[model samples]
Target: MRRMKVEQAAQVIDRPVYKAALIDFLYQLADDELFLGHRDSEWLGLAPDIEEDVAFSSIAQDEVGHATLFYHLLSELGEGKADDLAYSRPAAVRRNARLVERANGDWAYTIVRHLVYDIFEDVRLEALASSSYAPLAHGAVKIRREERYHLLHMETWFTRLGQAGGEAKARVERAVAAVWDDLGDLFSLGVHEAHIVAEGILPVARDELVQRWEARMKPLFEAAQLAWPGAPHPAKEDGRLGQHSADLDALLETMGEVYRIDPHARW
Candidate 1:
């Protein structure tokens, strides 16, 4: 597909159905990063090791930055200011996958979670890097560079923890079990999945992305000596459709607290 500027794409997708699909797609991308970044930042002063603390902090910042970029793109489409779009939305309206919205658990949980999420993000961004929406494609190229490091960092920890052959391995296994069920919806394209594909906003099919994600993780799981948690069950409520857990509600309360106190304050 030939790349087109946002304005050019807008002209082509003048119909409401196409426009709405594009917006929904962008929201899913932006919300995932924003929520996960917030979750990751929870480890700022709490990571097990100082180096990991610093590394995770940096990764968190990058995820937030990526969210900001996507939000800005949405703003260009007349959504609202990026900050308002990000902070003012209720949890019921957020489109991040359940995997990202769930609270960070133990260090092993965090490692496994990051491993799973980073692989998905890597695949998603690779697909987006060639998106017909030119600006998003450009942004994807930049974000994927930083994301590569995140994948490496998680993989290193994943392998080490798996090979440690003690409590660490057991903990990671437990974490995997806890999150496995919710993994099914991670690649869901929501209600307008077909329209989004037809409009060229998502260059790759959702199923293909899932396949790539699994392929990428298979070797990592093996090297880590971890069993692949087979076939995830459908989540009772998926975030793509704006259904979320109480954990997301709590997270939004904290995340938007400062903004709500004074939405106009410059900071």
Candidate 2:
């Protein structure tokens, strides 16, 4: 029985090819959310303002929840339990782009990542809402529902900080420029683009997704009075592609310390 009601509908591709694509796509989704969430969690009591702190905490939790959903999907594919897959992956094997692995840098940078990543994610999920694969299609629909809150939160801060002027404006501007270069790969298909599309899992092409993201972000940039910085850098066909940063390695070690000790032991 179909678990989700098919909505609008998308073109069907190939299945076997899509399975691997699905895995790759989900890995990017889960790993990015997990790493970003971990970094954000460190700021729990460190935020500058009480209200802002609470808001950041909520954003962190949402990222973790997003990761959990993707990990569960991976588990259904025989990868392992969601927790195991999430906490046990080797750093070098992680597929999250370098952008997410970098530290929050500053309140400005953190917000920058939140806005850029969240907006791009919104576009991607909206596109995926029509995924041909039943599971992904359904999951995308559910995720999109919660994502509205994220966008709203980020947009509020983005406008406040961007227009606040002086220190705040300078900080946000610097933050936006800092990560603009590395932000490109966040939309990359790596080597799975054709596979995913060929399998009819996702409706649109990866480039198409990038274009849509750029279009969606253009108005926000204008509203903030931020200038377009041209196209972001593409992944260098390693690490994110198959190559990863040292940060990921250390993250794995820390996250896995307890789990690896007694895989069968209940927490």
Candidate 3:
């Protein structure tokens, strides 16, 4: 694909019922992908193996693409330019959960994050694929088509690292345990959530969505001998509700540096 494709931006929904909620939903979607893409971009030249490096780069590119799509939607709503919204927001103002911004750590942690985040993203995207808002549903469909490869690549690593003896297994297990506490934050809907649900843009209940995610991921974790995380940590008191870790601060500095230099300059 080209560096970026201006696939038609989502059509404007003029009805008040859908308007604010959809915009908020779009921002959440855009923010999550933008931060995750930034995290992935950091790994461009740092992956363990060359073939793995190449495969990961493709996934990173897709994340960037997904961010661009939602950015365009936000731009159309007059919420500043897409790049500014992505790269100029204050760290606390960023809507992404801390999980997406956490450093990939060692190769094992990177793979662990990859497996966890990608699986969750796949579940969310599948839900979005059926969005009540036609444009979003369409965009989700297109994006999910590319997401299959991303999920597969990560799944393969999860299996390899899980079944591998000694060091690799220990690494993955530790990383998984570390991230389990923050997983629910990924599914959080913020203050604008009532409007989002009432507006029918994302029709599924949050718990149901999480359950679906669990169902989808359970088998993969079982096969790898990795335990699925127990208990749900609500985002209300969690780092996802604009309450983030220091890791987010570091990420925003790097992610926003280029855009903040001259927000008007065409890159």
Candidate 4:
């Protein structure tokens, strides 16, 4: 299929089914970045070292920027202003994977989580870079460029933590176990999987993308001498389906607190 620019896609999306599917796909992309970026921002002045704090701050900013880009695309589709879509939505309406919604635990947990999330994001964005939806494809290209740095940074930390042995290795191992169960939702497309794929918004199938994500991560896990955590179980509440954990509720409450206070007031 020929790539359709945002305007062209919007015209075709006059079909209700296509419009709903496109919106669902975009929300999944945008919410994941927004939630994870917010989680990363929690580390602002609290990262392990001064240098790492600076690096992580930059990464958080990038993730939020990526989220903003996706949200703007959603706004063009008439979902409302980007900030409103991001900050005003309730947890039940969010589309981010459960993995990102979990609270950041220790530095070990944070590092492992970042590594896992970035791997999945890397694959997802690669697929989007060729999306039949032109705006998403263009945005993916730019986001993926920045994501490369995130991947490198996380991988380095993952390896360092894994090889640190003793307490560090043990901590990372525990984090892996804690996070492994929720990973399945990263590939989930909810009930709209068929429509999203059928609409050709995402050129790759969800299963194929998941496979590619695992393939890329296996070697890295081995190199780090960490046992692959095996397959992830289905999420208890699928985030793609708008079913989320209480963690998300608390997160949204905090994230939107100031915005909700006076949404109309300029920041």
Name the lDDT value of residue 130 in candidate 1: 73
Once fitted onto the true fold, the runs of candidate 2 whose alpha carbons sit more than 4 angstroms away are 1-15, 237-239
lDDT of 3: 0.75
Decide which is better by TM-score, 3 or 4.
4
Tell me the spans in candidate 1 whose CA falls farther than 4 Å from its real position: 1-13
Q: Which model scores highest in TM-score?
A: 4
The residue-level lDDT of candidate 4 at 98 comes to: 91
Backbone clashes in model 2, listed as residue pairs? 13-200, 14-199, 238-243, 239-243, 239-244
Off by over 4 Å in 3: 1-17
Residue-level lDDT of model 3, residues 1-267, one tens digit each, is: 111111333444445545666776787788778777777778777888787677777777789889999888777777877777877777676677667878878777877777777777778778777676666778888988888888888888888889885999898888887777667678887766775665556767678777887787789878888777775577544444577788888888877777777889976
Q: For each candidate in the order shown, give its overall lDDT on alpha carbons.
A: 0.87, 0.76, 0.75, 0.87
Q: Write the per-residue lDDT of candidate 2 for residues 1-267, one digit (tens) a residue.
A: 122232321322233455677788889888888988877886889998988788778878988898998898787776889888788777766888777887777888888888888888888888777666677778888888888998888788787887778898888888888878677678776678776665555667778878887887777777777776666677664445857666667767776788888888876
Ranking by TM-score, best first? 4, 1, 3, 2
Candidate 1 residues 142-233, lDDT tens each?
A: 99998988988899999999999899999999999977867877888888899787677888898788889889988998999988887567
Please give, for residues 153-235, the per-residue lDDT of candidate 4 as tens digits: 88998988888799999999999998887887888987788877766788778879878988988998887889998767766
Model 3 Cα shift for residue 181 (angstroms): 1.7
TM-scores of the models, in the order given? 0.95, 0.88, 0.90, 0.96
Q: How many clashing residue pairs appear in each of the predictions shown? A: 0, 5, 0, 0
Candidate 2's TM-score reads: 0.88
